[model samples]
Target: MYIVGLSCYFHDASACVIRDGDIIAAAQEERFSRIKHDPKFPEKALTYCLQESKITLKEVDQIVFYDRLDQKRYRILDTYTSFAPLGKTMLWNAIRKWCGPSNPENDLYHSINTLSKKDGKIFYPHEIEFVDHHFSHAASAFFPSPYMESAILTIDGVGEYATTSYGQGKDNHVTLERQINFPNSLGLLYSAFTAYLGFRVNSGEYKVMGLAPYGSPTFQDRITEHIISWNPDGTYRLNSEYFNFFATEQITSSKFHKLFGGPPRKRESKITPKECDIAASIQAVTEEAILRLATYVREATNQKNLCLAGGVALNCVANSKLLRKKTFDHIWVQPAAGDAGGALGAALGFYYHYQKNERKISMNPYDSMKGCALGPSFSNEEIEIFLRKQGYPFERLSDRELFSKVSDLLVHEKVIGWFSGRMEFGPRALGHRSIIADPRSKKMQSLLNLKIKYRESFRPFAPSVLAERAGDYFELRTDSPYMLFVAQVASKHRIPVTEEAQKAQGIDAVKLQRSTIPAVTHVDYSARIQTVHKDTNSRYYHLIKTFEEKTDCAVLINTSFNVRGEPIVCTIQDAYRCFMRTEMDVFVLENYLLRKENQPVLFEDET
Candidate 1:
């Protein structure tokens, strides 16, 4: 049976199509639309999945949406109405979103109609079923995970009435034992701090996590005392007194504003020591909460393995702490752990659990995310067609020749936009859609951030190392193919601290060379790692291996293929556009390699 799953009208709207018991294709709308977090109906993503699956909409046997609209409406309306006259604007906005043009149902129907008409075909499924939002997240965690039985945890901003849900999964079935409802969300608490720190709410949480190591957690006591109360069983409650999200649509409360100082930091303003301290405090708090939660799950399930999902699972720093705590014998986090993966989870849940189909364990040790390379891919012919149509100059070479050439460019500290195979479904760019540079270059990180990424200079890049050599460079001993774990650079590669540098504070600490692989190492000598296994992506592995052979360094700086505010490039045109826009030195598309000098000049995007 074929199942089509969708999550839309929220951040990272996405679609996934599964055939029988395997994921055929998946992608997020932001990728195709060139938006950072597209909240549209995901028509383009759905169409792409269907095309990748070689099926039409009519051929899809089951349609499963990621959330129950009615349940969500109930909780949303209830929360807004309780705030009453004070929430007048917020209540009206919520009502308008549900009942007016913002209604997902309307966009979905229109998208389906438009797609069908554009294709000169019309069809509809028998019925569209909506699963609980948190269930979709939980299913995304446990179903494709490399565990027959495990403890499951899902935490996000809000999904209907559930903000955090935890339980256990056994075989093909999973159950939630308990849940912490909205207004008590760990995700929101983090996001509120994110906003207060002058970062975008959902999108800027990672920025907060990244900035934490720069300062001391001095504000931890004040935050814990005034903002939240916590229990040992992974349960947490935001005092609600310090948050006005439900009533004002502004995440922080008046008390929250005063506690953290009068006014929130304005976006794009200078990052202050106070902001860094706040980030550190919240990050420490988050790690404590997740660790407590993980400990609780381990005790409750008595299970050796654990599966984690939801947006909060995106916190690599916290994830690293949890992994180090050894609460479980094994942990498998859904690579696309946020709402994007909910599309895949909803389909998988309906197929194996609801359909009564037999479950099959993956032969691969890491489970069935397919390297998270489940998006659209174009053949060399198509790539050549695009180049030709655009009057672009390119040279085609054999894989061996191209690898050697690109490795040479990387060795010379040239930033290369590497586009190969299928696009990744999640926020990460795993080799297939990555901008790579020599990690050994001391100035490469700053160069790439300013010249190519056009974003914050404080953001550190990740290292894509050969799987066999990962432990040789990073403290991590396990597979982190998804770039989801932040592990310290192995001590052997760390640079000795100087007396002057030892006193370096804030981003100055970031400026110090903490490791031999300076470009990929963070201020604390931590590196978000993606270990490349030959079996999953042989070409990328071979390229890195070739680079290693030449330089005796297995690590290379890997960042997503797009600039600061854009999604990863999904199409050949998208790749070309980004390459032309950035100050990248080279572009690699499959076996073809093209230099920027050889291409036609285009208007540079300095934004």
Candidate 2:
């Protein structure tokens, strides 16, 4: 039997298809539409899923949507009705978005009719099912994890009535034991601070995480007292008077602005030390809550293993903290822990719970994500065809030759856009679609952010270390295949801070060399790490191995290959366009290489 799982009309809309409980294909719509965080019906993603799987809608046995629209609609209506004219705009917006003509109900049927018309037949009307939002998040984390049973926690902005849920999964079943409802969300609480700090909500939370290490946690007390009141039982309540999200579309209220003693920071404004301290304070408090919640989940479930999902699970700092507590013997997180992974979870949930498929666990390194490389991949022929059509200069070399050449360029400090294999499904680039650089270069962190990424300078880069050698550079032993956990730089490799570096504040500290691999190390000496196994990505492993042979360092900077305000490149065309626009020195699509100097001038020389 075949199952098509989908999540849409939410940020990062996506779709996935599974055959006999194995994922066949999965992709986000924004990658195809070129609209960052596209929240429309995932028709394009669904089309890609069908095409990638070499199947059609008629062949699918079930179409399970990630969330129950009607139940969510009821929650929105109930909340707005309680607030009345105070929530008029929010109410109207929710009504139009969910109850409008292009709503999920209509869109689902329209997709079937439009896409399945060729056969004069379609999937049965009963094939579709809409799951609860939090349930989907829980299922996404627990079902695909390599555990016979585990404690599950899912936290994000409100999902219907639930914002945070704690549960347990054993075999094919997941039981949500407790939940915290809307207007009292940890996700929204953090987002409120995100907006107050001049960053976009949802997308900019990671930016806050990156900035936290730059400042001291001076406002942790004020945030705890005024913004969110903590309960002892792994739950909390938001001070709605200080948060406007319940009645207004805005993330923060006037009270929130006054509490912080300023208006929200404007975008493109220079980030001050105050913003850094605020980021640090909130991160500190948030980590505490996450630890308390994880402890509570473990105590309540009596499970030895734990799984995490939802937007909060994407906070790598909190993840690192939770890992330190050792509340559970093993912890596994859904790499795409946000709404994108919801699509994959919804499908898995339907397969196990609804269809009663046998549960399977692939332990040691865990679960069925296949390193989250479950997206489209083009053959050498397809890549070459695109390159020739675009009139871009290129080279075709053998795998060994390509690795040798790219490794040599890295030794000389050239930023190379490495695009190979299938695109990664999760938010992380892994090694398949990444911008690789020599981690030994102290100046590379600033250069890549300002020149190539065109984003905030405070942001830190992650390291993709050779799996066997990860222990040498980072204080870690387990495989971090997904780049989900932040580990401290191994003490042996850390550089002592200078008096000048210690006195530096704000962005100046970025100039300080914190470790041997300073480009990938944060100010606090932490690195979000991805361990590249030779078993999974041999090509990426070989490239890093070649570089290691040349420089005696196995770690390299591996960041998503895109600029600010852009999704990670999904096609060779997207890769080329990004390469031409950025200050990237080299571009590698599959085994082909293209240098910026030899390419046609994309713009008139400003000099």
Candidate 3:
């Protein structure tokens, strides 16, 4: 049986199709829409899934929505009603969103029918299955994991009434034991700080994570004292006085600004020491909360393994702390841990739990994400046709020749846009849609940020290392295929900072080279790592391995294949446009390589 799952009307709108127990296709709408975090109905993504699965909409046995609309409506009403006159504006907006002409709850059937109309054929499922939001998150975590039974934790901003849920999965069944309700969310608290620190909420939390190590956690006590009330059982309540999420669209309120000693930093403004300290303080608090929660889950479920999902699970720094503490014997995190993966989770939950289908674990140790290489792929013939039509210069080489050539370019410090195979399903680029460079260059990080990514200079790049050689370079001893965990650079690779460098504060400290792989290493001597497995992405694996053979270092700096505020490049045209837009030296589309100097100058109005 074929099942289709969808999550939309929220950030990272996505669709996933599963056959029997296998995920056939999954992608976010932003990839096709060219809008970062497109929150509209995922018609294009759903169509792509159907096309990739080689099935028509009529052939899909079931359709599932990630969260129940009624539940969300109730939560919105309850919160807005309590906040009343003060929240009049927010209340009207909520009502308009739900009762408006474009309401998702009212138009899902129409949207689905409209998209499936090919050759004038239109079909809708008998009934749409609505799963609980947190349940979808939990299922997304437990079902795809390589665990027969494992503790489950799902934490995010408000999902219906639940902010956090924890339990366990055994066999095909997942049990959510307890929950923390909305208005007391750790995710919201972090996002509040993200906005206050001159970043976008939901999108900029990771920026705060990246900036944390530049300053001390001097305000951690202040944050704990004024913002949250903690319980010994790892449960906590937000003070709520400092927040305006319920009363207004803004996340933080006047009280929050007063406590912080000022209003939020202006967006795109220069970083200040205050903002860095705020980031460090919140990061420290978030890590402590997550550690406490993981400890509680380990004690309660007594499960040797743990599966984490939801937005908070995206915090690699917090995830690293969880790993170092060894709260569980093993941990698995969904690559699309945010709302995008909720689509997958919803489908898996309905299949294994609701439909009573038997579960089959894959022989692959990487679980069932298929290395997240589940998006659309272009064959060499199609790419060649495009290159020829555009009159772009290119050359095709065998895999061996291309790998050797790319490795040689990296040795000469040439930044390359490497687009290969299928695009990734999650926010992370992985190797399939990555801009790669030599990690050993001290200047590569800033160069990529300013000239290539056209974003903040302090944002650190990730390291894609051979899976077998991961521990040789970093302290990680296990797989991190999703780049979801941060590990300290091994002591052997770390460099001692000079006295002057040590004294540098805040963003200035980013200039210090803390490790041999300076481009990928953060100011804290930690690196977000993606372990490339030969079994998963052999081409990328061989490329890195070949580079390692030449340089005697097994790591390559990998960042998403896009500029600031854009989704990762999804097509050859997107990749080519990005290559030409940036200061990149080379572009690789499968076996074809085109140097910037060989390409004609692209005019802004040409397209």
Best by lDDT: 3
Report, for all candidates in order, the number of backbone clashes.
Answer: 0, 0, 0
Best candidate, TM-score-wise? 3
Alpha-carbon lDDT of model 3: 0.92
Alpha-carbon local distance difference test for all models: 0.88, 0.88, 0.92
Evaluate model 3: give its TM-score.
0.98
Residue-level lDDT of model 2, residues 1-607, one tens digit each, is 7788888886999999988878888999989898999988788888889998888887888888888887887887787877677878777676786765677777777776677787566655565788988888999998878887889999998787899999989899888888999978899888888988988887999999999999889889999888778788878877778977777777688888888888999998999989999999999988999998998888888989889999999998898888888888888899999999999889999899877889877643557888888888889999888888867889999999999999999999999999999899979999888999999998899999999999988889999999999999999856789999999999999999978669999777888998999999999999999999887788899999999998999999999998999999998878888888999999998889999999987643311
Q: Candidate 1 clashing pairs?
A: none
Writing each residue's lDDT as its tens digit, candidate 3 over 1-607 gives 9999999998999999999979999999999999999988999999999999998887888899999888888888888778877788777777787765678876887888776666355554447889999999999999999999999999998799999889999999999999999899999999999999989987998999999988789999998998987898999999978998877888898999999899999999899888899999999999999998899889899999999999999998898889888889899999999999999999999999999899988888779999999999999999999999989999899999999999999989999999999999988999999999999998999999999999998898999999999999999966999999989899999999998779998899888888889999888889999999999999999999899899899999999999999999999989999999999999999999999999999987653
**Residue by residue across 1-607, what tens digits does model 1's lDDT show?**
9999999888999999999879899999999898888988898899999998998877778789999877887887788768766688777777777776668776676677677676565545337778988889999999898888889999899999999999888887878889999878999899889998889987988999889988899999998898878887778888878888877877787788888787899899888778878899999999999998888888888999889999999998898889998988888899999999999999999988788787888887888889999999889999888788777889999998998999899988899999999999888999999999999999998999999999888888999999999989999957899989999999999988899878987776777887889999988888899999998888899999999989999988999999989999998888888999899999999988999999877755421
What TM-score fits each model? 0.97, 0.97, 0.98
lDDT for position 202 in model 1 = 71
Which pairs of residues have clashing backbones in candidate 2? none
Sorted on lDDT, best first, the list reads 3, 1, 2
After the best TM-score superposition of candidate 3, give how far the Cα of residue 537 lies from its true spot, in angstroms.
Answer: 1.0
